[model samples]
Target: MTRRITVAGVSKFFYLYENHSNKLKSTLTNLARLRMRKRRKFWALQDLDFTVDQGEVLGIVGRNGSGKSTLLKILSRITVPSKGRIEMFGRVNTLLEVGTGFHPELTGRENVFLNGSILGMSRSEIKSKFDEIVTFAEVEAFLDTPIKHFSSGMFVRLAFSVAAHLEPDILIVDEVLAVGDQQFQMKCLQKMEEAMSQGRTVLFVSHDMRAIRRLCKRVLFLDQGRIVHDGPQEEVIAMYLQSFEDLAHIPFPDSESRQGSGALRFENLALIGSDGVPRDEVAAGSDTILRMRYRCLSHLQNVIFSLTISSLTGQILFRCISTVELDSPFSVSKDGVVDCRFPRLNLNVGGYLVEIEASANGVLADRVREAMRLQVVKGAYYEGALPNRQSQVLVDYSWQINPDGA
Candidate 1:
């Protein structure tokens, strides 16, 4: 099959701030007397190579300022590449930024045709699909209202509706989906899936890993304007999420005096592997250790402390409290620090937060909301029947396929 979109060694450079002129004071000083500002080059894209077959949905995942938007802009022809080559075989419709091609002065109804024409759609073609676009966006009430009066949400809704329904062979989407509500985002996802099933090509850039994993068979991981990984969805997303987790940890302050609830305060929380040295990063499916130190005020009895391990979504994966076992209740004296250690962490490849909570006599007590977040980075995983807390839960069981089919 011939490739529908081919990007070979694509490189895009941009000036940090182009076309600088002192307007108010300089206009009277004479046009020729104005000082020309020197321009500095910034490379938004570098030697990027990828080919999309006739019917492929490619997902791009990266953090903010990763140049994902710049790549999409280059593909949409809104910006030209500084040094690279690209070939497109069919009509391309892009939903790049918020209200990229919409005319604020024109009514929503009028802008649809204007955008369609800009995408090379015929007037009759747009006319036949006009109502459908308005209905899909659910902006019929504001169709006659000028786009300048519409809210940001309304503008993006109408813009996406126009771009998606134009029937372009290749569709490019950036983070613009974030403008819609959850239900609308799902609707757009379904539409993209339908388009993919019909053999249309799509290039999606989003920070949402779940959407990327669900829609695309392959993904590209971008870092600082360069492609670091391009492969299966699982692998690429894993790499990107790992990189994110590594960077999530902010350096602890040097001051030993940390503020917290006066009743109880946590002094330090650190990640220590089997080696006992402090570590900021840990591999997934490994024996890791979490150590926390805290000071208690006023001697308390029947004190139960709980540790919660959670993902970025606030889903609790592992929980351990002193009350799980009735054998005894943990107690701490007044004005002294205590330590708690959790060994053998079994988490998949992702970032997790360790939160500590303490209560007395079954009453509400103090807790650290997001005390520390850890990144579980690795490829290997243990799969078995376990409580489906999150996507991957390990029961730590081993099975073998015997000839008797056990």
Candidate 2:
């Protein structure tokens, strides 16, 4: 089989300057100082070798700054590699960013034709597909309005619709689909599936493991600008997720990113089983507790602590809020621990993330994303059987039926 895309020893290097002044200074200093410079060279991708068959759908997964976007940009030809080579055998279309390849001043209607031309489509071809694109995007009402006026969701919908309908042989998609609502995201996923069914090659990058598992047969896991694992989707995703198993409890200040007023910040986070023992693994149908230790820098009133349970892919599955769930106005005047106990955690066997948020008087005090990780194992849920991954949560219910002649 012919390889549709071949990336061999591809590496991209970028220089980091402190500021505009530093960038200018570095340029001048390099000229006079010969080898002395303050700028730092960062490798976005390094020695990445991969090939895609004529009709393969490949998924790329990594944490932030993992070179996923850098690899995609190189593949899409948006940027040149500092070293190595790439060979592509078909017309390529890319959706690497929000409103990519779009003219903000042009109306949505005009951009469709413009994008089609860029994709090597004739005017007649674009005209024939114009209606379908607009209908699929559901942006007919704003067809003539400049894209600058469109919201992020609208931009994503229209941009994805055009790229998917342009009939390119190779499509490269980034994580931009997260900008749209769930319905539109699903629509885009379905369209990608349809394109794959038609024998088109796709390179998809997403944090959504479920979507990746559903679409791609192979996966590439990148870390620190290198391909750490590249193989079957299930194996790669499992390896990628298992790497985070050690982060059972994370200190708030040591978190990579955080937001809020900082009046109150979480000190630590942990997951405990029914026996109140800190454990990363919990039974599917057993009770579990999420404990958050926090300190109040100042007196705060009407503070609510909320915890959100999300899948490994970052989809929020369930949320518990102190104000809403407990029906009590929470306040913090000193250091304490807030425990969110679930009577029965029905999540199937999988890895999940916990996010914590603290707010005071309707103002955000502190928030942490993916503060903790937990793994659910086989338990008494669904007659002691593990539910399929497709089912987000397992629910207990009873069914009743009436006889025909009751």
| Candidate 1 per-residue lDDT over residues 54-142, each given as its tens digit | 88889997765678989998999988999989999997888765445777899998999888887778999999999998999889999
Native-vs-model 2 lDDT? Answer: 0.80
Count of steric clashes across candidates, in order = 0, 0
Model 2 stretches astray by more than 4 angstroms: 18-26, 29-35, 146-155, 249-324, 328-406
RMSD of candidate 1 to the truth, in angstroms, is: 15.6
Per-residue alpha-carbon lDDT of model 2 for 182-250, expressed as tens digits? 567678778878999989899998766667888999999998899999999989988877654445334
Q: What are the RMSDs of all candidates, in order?
A: 15.6, 14.1
Candidate 1, superposed: residue stretches over 4 Å from native: 16-40, 101-105, 145-156, 255-406
Q: Lowest lDDT 10-mer window, candidate 2?
A: 378-387
Q: Which has the greatest lDDT?
A: 2
